[model samples]
Target chain A: MTDKIPVTVLTGYLGAGKTTLLNRILSEPHGKKYAVIVNEFGEIGIDNELIVGADEEVFEMNNGCICCTVRGDLIRIIDGLMRRKGKFDAIIVETTGLADPAPVAQTFFVDEAVGRRTRLDAVVAVADAKWLKDRLKDAPEAKNQIAFADVILVNKTDLVTPEELREIEMRVRAINPYARLHRTQRCSVPLGDVLARNAFDLERILDLEPAFLGSDGGAHHPDHGRDGAHAHHHDGMAHYHDEEIQSVSLRTEEPLDPDKFFPWVQDLVAKDGPSILRCKGILAFQGDPQRFVFQGIHMILDGDHQRPWREDEKRESRIVFIGRNLPEENIRRGFAACQV
Target chain B: MTDADTASLTERTRAIVPGGLVAAVHFLKDTAAFVLGEAALLLAAPNREQRRVAIHDGGILAAACDGQRLVTGGDDGKVMATDAGADSTIVAVDPKRRWIDQVAIGSGAVAWSAGRQVFVKTAKSEERTTDVPSSAGGLAFAPKGFRLAIAHYNGATLWFPNAAAAPERLEWKGSHLAVTFSPDGKFLVTAMQEPMLHGWRLADAKHMRMAGYAAKVRSLDWTADGDWLATGGSNQLILWPFAGKDGPLGKMPRMLAPAQGLAVEVACHPRQPVVAVGFADGLVLLVRLDDGAEIVARRPGAAPVSALAWNATGSLLAFGTEDGEAGIVDLG
Candidate 1:
């Protein structure tokens, strides 16, 4: 077994100082080689010349988001880099401003060859303390980016006063309390602060997630006792629109039959392909403790088995979707239909 | 009539719909519009007074009008079914596979192909099973019949509704993207994504190669007369006069303003020489072949127009978009 190389994903709203933070990390003399990927090396005719040692290891997809069109290119590049083994100590993926990170994280889990070599260290998002407050008011993508982040850096601190920064930080925390917060100018934070920060603590996340991550760190919930009428509280974090997009997470203790799961997923895509942006899950199949990872964009889906369940870990399944005006009750019923 | 006379007549009938609402009949039950992004589908009744019998989700990958029930296959690897007056139901789902690229239903049997595998289910059984090779991309049901013709990744295959008989395969070398059978089932036309169109004599397996577009051929339809083939891609529609004498005549299918965006779906007027083209930029163009005139050009919504279909009478046109919007245009 190869040692899992930690991967950190950097995301932010457009012009939120993500590239600035990446530049700071590259300049530091941490003695660890970092492979960085971005949407474009040169935008508006301005080249990315600030990052140190980016010439050899840096790659620009230029094809749009790292999730959809350029995924194949991403897999090939990461696979080749891994083959070199000693060339880079870690990988940092900088997503496009409007990208959804679920698909990027899913790439690491769904691909067998890639999963063995890389581990998802954390998802770090940079926010323009001033712009984020307004952007999240109407943009579903912006809110979703904040909600899914494991760590958030409130950048452009110089533009806002300490009190304003604190307010923004509080707002972010309200939406996602799990993420660690930091304030910086031009995303100029220390590399140590961002690197090796494992934010996806299974136990902690499971505790916060009552429906999926039980207190036991298992994905199952023994309490069917709760009424099926459990309403999801947006908690003032999510903005509702008649055509708004919603992200929902579902977990199951029962193993899914691949036959049933496969068709159920297909039907959802067919029925609502335009509204669905991303769908991902770690499934536990009957008699198999090994994790089955599934990820999709619109209608395109790719799935495979990752490592077998660790002897110390419990087997359970969890799935999440980020989409526009998703009928939560209908989706839940559809998932319920998938139950054996 | 000779081929020229037929072309002239079709050009004349193209003015009937001349844009605007070609048909509109509200459903007794409320039905939501579901957009498949690149395509869209809706489940609604054809009339406000009929029993809920079918759902229709217009998808470019596959579109099925089964009695009053309409089923659509989306690029997202899903098959949705709905009775005319009821909400949509996901009859089959495969999120882990490639798009449900094409769908066809007939003789109470429905078959769809996604990322190479073809799945079929009949009204007699509630369960659907994979029944074809994985390389299949396009599929069609023999008109008013139980047999199915599937355009595989490399070729095409004809299958019986019952599993008792083995499928007959027709080998080809190209990536077949679309397939349609002639009205009499005597000929099968396959369109390649490479922009090449071919006609095959199903009885003897003879093939004829024809001219196609410069880019991927996204939508294709055959006129009821079987004398014209309407193909569109790269925002332009081409009317192939299959039976014309004008130097193997193939002219741009007349439409309201050259199709302005990516043409995603196209349907021929069931009984006329007219054709309807739906675009990725949400524009719908009704074209007449007689003088190559565009009769209608309208943007129904902000999303891309993904699917298009003409009802039984060829009077009502239904279209769906990526933004979950569906509209009915009345040609009457």
Candidate 2:
């Protein structure tokens, strides 16, 4: 699996320093070669031979299913890049300011040739720290860039005051509490923080828990903490309720019935996959001794038995969803029905 | 042939290491031309003499051979034609340095795509350009006409380079990748983005949906008589019959040579009904269409077999793998 090339997707609103981050990655002295696929070519001044332009063409698969859509241009570009396999160490795809991240993420899942030759490292979103609070209110694409990201860079923090920065962080957290956030000026975060993150790998499901358990005080008594009932206290600030998008975290000590859980989750995603952008879970089955790690992009779910549960580890099931207008009550009751 | 006579014929072939991923192999006369994923093409002669010829400044993206010269398009924005004598010449270059996405060789013309536009250059006339609605996913020239088929999202456009009429559009709902016409010029088939092959009967504009593939159908070839269209996408060799007027519209495809690995490439014999099947696990088998008798040409210990081809006379077979391992088998 290590032989597969790692691809990092960079997204942001216009004037959010995406090109700055790309140029930085290209000009860094890391001694690693990168093939950059950018929608806008002349914006990147780097003279790298591996830099290729993309058209950002998205098309539907499985007979016009919206959730099954993928980037047709990515499927073609990756296939072309694989011909020069040894020329580059990793690939970075920079999307347009108005581009949706769903088609880019789903391209890795839907295309067999792309999935086999390369692994999606992570989705890195660069946000203008001063203007993000306003963009989130007006641009739906800006909110998605934050919610679908695995790592986010709040760039241009020098222009915003400390209090304004705190407000921006709170608003981002209210929408997506899962992504690893970093504050940077001119998008100057460490190169390691954004690249080579195996965010989509099934084995990396272990990292999802810390993102959920770290901030919310509800992690200690998660059973009493029903879905959509986060206390939303961050640095003693009141919960900023962004009504359109939110993250729901569910946990239970009871082992789930695999037969019941599979059908319920499948049906739920089928009905609400458009609203549910991303969902991941590390499940504990009733009779199986192995832990099942599953992750989804829209309606597509990929799950497998990771390893045998260690005796020292607690056999708990935790599921998290970052979506818009999720059926909170129905999801909570359906998950309860899966508990044995 | 008896089962014992055809089994385990791995020693009947001569191995040649090309040392780069072989995207395709085409037989020019008696020489096996192995098109590498990078800049060169390996030409192996019948006497086992191999020569490497550089055809592109960078990676070769698309290639097509018309029994004389191999025409290839590359990331260097140049289209080149190389012959069996190791001689190469630039055919065309994109002024904007766009990656040449697809290429097709017509009777006397060479066609290639850069972004959404396709350029066709004939032997006697200058190049003509036409822009499609989307990026051209695949390009194929009709067997008997000067027309070219450009496969893209929503459908394929059939264009005649000399005609003044608006190009014909065959509307299908999904993105179409590789495309080819039957040898008899009756049907046009396209490998879609989905795991299926969609075809249109040219006479009546009828649609034929060939589904039930586990993966996208990347490689397909018509038999010598155009009786069957062999495809790669499943663990078994799938052949959709096109002998009837309706094509494989209501018929079931004949599946053969079930294996542990998915078949990734298929090359039909030019003079016989046998097919050379290449699998993802680096296995190559020559299976007869009559009874599905299999002859193991290469064993499974390397990368997927990405390319396979037979000489015009069907006396020699050449196969190449993704790991750059190549071999030529003599069956005369």
Candidate 1: misplaced stretches above 4 Å? A1-340, B1-63, B72-80, B87-101, B126-133, B163-165, B242-262, B299-304, B323-326
Interface RMSD of each: 17.7, 1.0
Error of 2 at B331 (Å): 1.1
Candidate 2 chain A, which ten residues in sequence have the lowest lDDT sum?
A217-226
lDDT of 1 by residue, B131-233 (tens): 5443455788888567788875457888775666678888765556578877667777787634567667776777666654555565678877877777766
lDDT, candidate 1, at B228: 72
Give the DockQ (2 decimals) of all models: 0.01, 0.74
- Model 2, B1-332: lDDT tens digits are 54455553566788889998999999888999999999899999887899999888888999999878889999999999888787888899999999999999987999999989999999785889899999999999999979999999999999998898989999999999999999988999999999999999999889999999999998999999899999999998999999999899899999999999999999999988899999999998888999998888888966999899998899889999998898988888
Q: For candidate 2, lDDT tens digit of each residue in A1-340?
A: 8899999999999999999999999999999999999988799888999989999998999654567899998999999999999999999999999988989999998899999999888999999998999999999999999889888888998999977876777787777777777788988878888897788889987865656543241212211112233333445566576778877788898999999999999999889999998888999999899999998988988999999999999999988888998888888899999999
lDDT of 2: 0.88
